[model samples]
Target: MTRILLIGAPIAVAVSVWFGGDGEPQRPKDDPSLRISRTAAAPDPLKAGTPEQQRELEERIDALPPGLADPAKKEIAARLVASAENSTLDWRSQYGVIEDIGDGNGYTAGIIGFCSGTNDMLQLVEHFTERHPGNPLARYLPALREVDGSDSHEGLGAPFEAAWAKAAQDPAFREAQDLMRDRIYFDPAVRLAKMDGLSTLGQFIYYDAMVLHGPGLGPQGFYGIREAAMAAADTAAEGGDEKAFLGAFLDAGRHVISRQKTEQTRDSSRIDTAQRVFLRQGNMDLQTPLEWRVYGETFRIDS
Candidate 1:
């Protein structure tokens, strides 16, 4: 059996062969079960080239204008996400926020909208309980688990909501939320965007998508949306135009948002008005003072 791969400037390829006992290449006639594998082994469309190329990409990303990870840019990212999540720039104010919002995910709470119907809220509480023994929300673990996949408030109600609000007051709880947000969303989004050779604006775009869509690898999840975008246009790391790739990425995100069949999910102003505005204005680096609208309300981040 032989495998042949074609290597290009940014893609890799190779070829291999299996010889018979006679030391000659096996053929269909020589062996009925013999098989030949031919494949197009290209570099990951979402990743840079070789190790040295990846290193260069990382350095270039780090040297670019301060990205989402920068203290200022990160704060700006939070505000941008908050505008869509809470309709306010005061992200910290959302720490104590908890409500069902009729989204079918059960109680949506905290800064990143962890939903009880989804497994993330369970993970968030589990993480917090692990760090701080017997926290206010620990007792609701059973109920949270029970309602992990439905909109039922079977075992959680006012008591659970009150406990959540009370837990929010503790600095430790707030810190736990921040840690989980970064662990589950922020860090992975930013890291992947950088590897894709995206600019600061791209990093923010990825983070925003992660916030709205869970980090799941499913077809509608954050990574799936990215994959769809890559299918449309090569990522910057793949030697494609950054603007084009980002535009495709935004389009993919919008498509996923539109399919949810909910009023709130149907409104993709976060990408349409906000991100597209920046993309249209050619703010790939995401340099501010910036202004955009979401849900018909305008927001700004000046520095």
Candidate 2:
């Protein structure tokens, strides 16, 4: 959503197994902190796409109270988001770059699809460079900066493409991917939700929109939507009803989603519709077996 990541991929949702541990559904074996002998869930090699099982996996994590009692357990939210955003639950799947997609960047990259024009992409490149100084992608910093707002492939050539390919193969680069998302979407949304007395669903709604519209006060940006929602109804943060605020917030989100020209696939529409349906059903906690449609493709996770 951040940039035009959904250029032209397969339309049908793949529904793979969702990631866990840190904002993931299950801890990885490679993590040093966990002892290696428990009967935890095995890693599903093929899981992490637009699969029915992804929804089923998310429905199982009812760890938080209504208003996101714990942001640490962000697995379900991120997991469910995979189906809507990337059609893949693995956060790692979203780290590649695409050039010249008319998206203000010849090098838009990362999970939330940070575009070169947006400073977020600068931060992403900077962070990656800092962690892995000698990384192949480091040399292209200047070219990346130069091409920030232009779709022109100008100075970037095989080196740039190879660097991105190399970065994808490194473990440290993968860490940077999650860090960027946290800095841009997850962390801010959770923090704001806590401030606004919003539940996990509200947190998710904010996070999801931020990923799409970028996090500012422009006409269709995340802040603008929230501002519009605030005008329509008072948030619990302002000593008003939480449900009313959430409903208003949702309406605002749908407005933004409707206008995004890059949403060629309309997968984002389901993100809004699903929340609207849940809120309509008074499922403020965003309890599962959720159902909705994106571009006329209906999805029901009632089981």
| Candidate with best lDDT | 1
Write model 2 residue lDDT over 1-303, tens digit each, in one string.
Answer: 443322211112122113343333332334433211112221221333335543443443333243543543366566556656555556557677545444344555566666666666667778989877998878778876777655656567766767776787888887887777776666656555644556667777777776766665444666566667767776664456877888888777777666655655234565556667766777666666667665555665543
* Residue-pair clash count for candidate 2: 20
Collision count of model 1: 2
* lDDT (10s digit) by residue, model 1, range 1-303: 000111111111111112333422222343332221222222233343345544543454445444689898899899998999999999999999999877667788999888887677888899899888789999999998898877788888999999999999999999999988887778777866765667889999988887787765555666667777877886665557889999999998888777775787678899899999999999877788999999999998887
Best model number under TM-score: 1
lDDT of each: 0.73, 0.58
TM-score per model over all chains:
0.80, 0.69
